[model samples]
Target: MVLLRTLRGPAYTRILGIGDYRPARIISNEELCRHIDSTDEWIQDRSGIQQRRQATPDESVVDMGTQAARAAMTYADLTGSDIDAVICATITHPYQTPAAAPMIAERLGTKNAAAFDLSAACAGYCYGVAVADDMVRSGRAEHVLVVGVEKLSDYRDLGDRGTAFIFGDGAGAAVIGPSATPGISATTWGSDGSGSAMISQSVSWTEAQERYAPASLDMPGDPARPDATVTDSLWPFIDMQGPSVFRWAATAVAPLCERALAAAGVTAQDIQVFIPHQANTRIVDTLVKKLRLPDHVVIADDITDMANTSAASIPLATAALLRSGRAHPGDLALQIGFGAGLTWAAQVVQLP
Candidate 1:
């Protein structure tokens, strides 16, 4: 007869620190108006974005993510060698081969770190945080770095007013480690595949290549749409139905936050901060009113300056709030992320 092995119990986990990196150059609405028909007032009134950061020509997704991870490690008082796993959440990675996470880990000197990329578009970071936290709780890793980074400027169609002024580039990171008490509560995550088409790239790379190749089929520009000027080549950029996304975000996400709060055994009044994805100010405003969070609860609106950085928005906004003293260590915060995949994830966490 063989004896049975004892199983290890799940450990508690919490975020240790957070960091963010924004590109050096800032592009204002005035600058964007030069290429698109939209004016500063219209852009501001519609999206509440005055300006956004644009990555320098030399910057790559890995470059921004590495900087972000390093900053997070520094804040956590740990070096890359201390990290056991790295999870990068991004949609703008340039290459189809060699995912961004390993490259970032190597640059940060994390030798043989378990690294990979997670793609859920704007909801990627929240998904990453949920995974990282679970990894720690399950004893799969001691310290995990979750980074949300994007280089949306590379794909933005300059003449397309819908997206031209709405995206930027940046990276944000958080270090998750063991905690004595529950720091990150159970996550509330789900997806609506039916709405996936509401946000997507205009065309796949292979299709674009095949269609735009020499001696390819006729692919003329649309005469009706002012910005559809490409006659031969097509750049696969992000496209979305703005009103549709707004409606889904405004109506669906509030209940998820409530579920997350309940999972954490907390209430809206108990939350000190509300950090939803920085998609737009109007969405933020709608969520705030619907949630009926107390007047004292701080709400993040980094979209005004950072624009929508996709996967990078949540962590970036969280880091900004903590760094600016709008939120503090030990405060309870509710974080919700929703986007492409028509995916969403929410959780209540105690601030590091």
Candidate 2:
């Protein structure tokens, strides 16, 4: 097992409550096949994604994030004013001017609360959770709202098979408060910036040509190589290195999982559930085999029904499991996230 370098910190921060919001409108694979050149069978075979939920045309990232925050605050029996801080994770926000988190706090009526946005790609929620856990544990804040919300479809190139079939829209959230024991036990986290170039969104400018500049959101194409003078033509859409990502995810997630389990002094058998990032079912299955955890460990994922919600995936699945009575109070649960940044993290948590 991988060992910790620093002594374990006190368990003073805990996840007190959680909530999620999925748009009422659903997008099925068959419907996508009609719009794009894809088949339900093919999409399932590649990513195990059968369908997705997308926000209404009128809904936006901040709106979804705010909505999820409200639900979490209600569950925590706290008002926006009660929260000392807020951290929102999203790759897609409506505008580049005003940060989404502060706007959400305003919408939630949190007075003078510190708030900001975070982007660790799909691994954002894990990172955010870790950040909030620390801030609260250090007595910097009492109650913090860590939100993972995304609207990937709004910027998607619906015609591309790789990305279109992989993303859906939704939001998930958690209210973290101080806990005495069995709260956030141990977490393993790391990132590789070199991999950040692999996935992104971009825009360009033209010399002395105002007409050439488009104000609308545009996809940032892949980075240029010195050897290849010819950069491919630009398109507005998402991109993925399917095979590389799958490999990285499978290999990257296992170590973090092992470390977190060890830190909690819990065996794999002690874990009541494993809520992995909802990037792909294939990756989850691969890790399940690698870890050799319990067959009844109760792995939860909603990608088949909700698609990949990026940072929102794990918390969304966790909340859904709780709502359905799958994950009960005080149960031992583990969560892991891995994606762009080539980042990954794992933490063992106790249900409140």
Candidate 3:
């Protein structure tokens, strides 16, 4: 066993860089309508999504995540060897035993860096940001990489109207390092477990496996029979109560934003960008109106192109805003993420 040493001091943490990786395959609304009972106009009117990116089989969650991380490191003018820790936020990691963080660290060549994964659904990115800030402030780390990635194409049910059109695959990352001045404010987070079922998998993986387990090696029915069939449950896919989620997002999440702003000692008018999770365009509009933000505040609408990327949504939206010239470094931005766990988190931070 090895001994560990701890350090203590007051430090400030700020995001040094941001990066994102969107899959190459773009699926238009017309293409989606082919598989589900949805139309371009209907999808636009409801979700404001015209197209979404779907990852190919070659693009695994870790692959996209590592790419985003490398880009972020480059933008920060640092190398993998410079990182002290890594935090990977995702719910779509294919393996159940080993987390995705260590693999990401290994690929980044951060052999001595502490690595781990966090699962908070759509709220994961913001939570990771909060944790990174705290870790730096407490002198536990000097530089940290926070990555949010998802491969929802593997979990989406193409025939389900409720979710078939709402998910996409992508990854986004940010580099957090010590700063001489404050760059990130306090975070506000909460969850309503009673509503956890509003967004979740239709069935658990173990349950699905058991449901399809063979009754016996000897076939119960004739193998050649035309009518022979096996009773099995629907494939485990992401599902959501659309109305419930919309209601909760539009109404309940506004207070969390208010709390975040208050904690940061800022007002709605002080914000330069509002980066909420790309869950729905309508929800973004609702929050903007409910918060009474000024017309000058740029709101992220990445959902139109990337759909809801769950834990990756906030970082993805942030990167898009910065890349589009709509927001700039040192700008004040408010970010909020909510989903699956009936969880939500928010924070106000200055851009890199």
Candidate 4:
């Protein structure tokens, strides 16, 4: 029997830097209300979103992700050659075969680094952070680029009142590398697949291709199909059971956060910031009350301005806090993300 040598890495890992990209196009509640039957006040009372960003038609998921990744790398004082791996978390990449990570890696000029995509819906960014932290500490990668991006405009249904005004397009990224002291703590994450249907696309890709391909293939000016009209059903749009999701998030997620804090061996008073998923203000408020967090802990409310950028929410919120001087380097932050898949991930970290 031959003995194999084992690889070991650093004692700790920290997020070296963070970045995000918000598209230039801003869609206010008044504008969104023009398409849906909702009023701006109603939308605000429901989801606390006054506006959101939507990428242009030419902006692909890779494009937004690459820009965000570049920003993160720049903040970390790193270049493509320094990245050993890239992980992109997204559900709206539009392609199923070729993942978005490698494309982002190519755009960044990475030197053949390991790359892949992750599909954890809104919980994705936090999931990527956990994975990157492990990879760095295990010596699998020296520096890992984790990007959470979503071009949700492609899947938005203006006619759907429940979700039409709830989503936005954006990208956020982080660079994780070795640290002298612990910066990332144990992550408390889990999923309840039983509630998977609470938030999802109206149809799978297979269903869309099989059901709508024949009609979609016809030319618009074809003489035989001069009156052809494509309905919203021809493409998959976001479908969500709002009440159920809100209930689960408001009630169940607080305990998960408690576990994360406990796992980190810290109390709520030790945290300087609380960055929860920018899903809804009501949910955030409920979690705050349940956790009994003090007033000094700055809670992120980026949802009011950014809407739900799915996986990009936490990091984008983090970046906002940093820019506004609400959060500082080495400050302890407790972050949690939960959505779709009824998934949830929470962790405590020292902000970069």
> Clashes in each model (backbone N, CA, C under 3 Å)?
0, 1, 0, 0
State which candidate, 1 or 2, has the greater lDDT.
1
For model 2, residues 154-218, the per-residue Cα lDDT tens digits are: 65655566676788899999999887764887677888988765565533323212322242225
* Predicted structure 2: lDDT: 0.79
2 or 3, which is superior by TM-score?
3
Model 4 per-residue lDDT at 143:
98
Judging by TM-score, tell me the better candidate of 2 and 4.
Answer: 4
Which one wins by TM-score: 3 or 4?
4
In terms of TM-score, which candidate is strongest? 4
Instruction: Name the regions of candidate 1 deviating beyond 4 angstroms.
Output: 1-10, 209-235
Residue range with the least summed lDDT across 10 consecutive positions in model 3:
222-231
Model 1, 170-212: lDDT tens digits are 9999999999988998999989999988999878887756655
lDDT of 4 at 166: 94
RMSD in order of candidates = 4.2, 7.7, 5.5, 3.9
Which one is best on lDDT?
A: 4
Clashing residue pairs in candidate 4 are: none
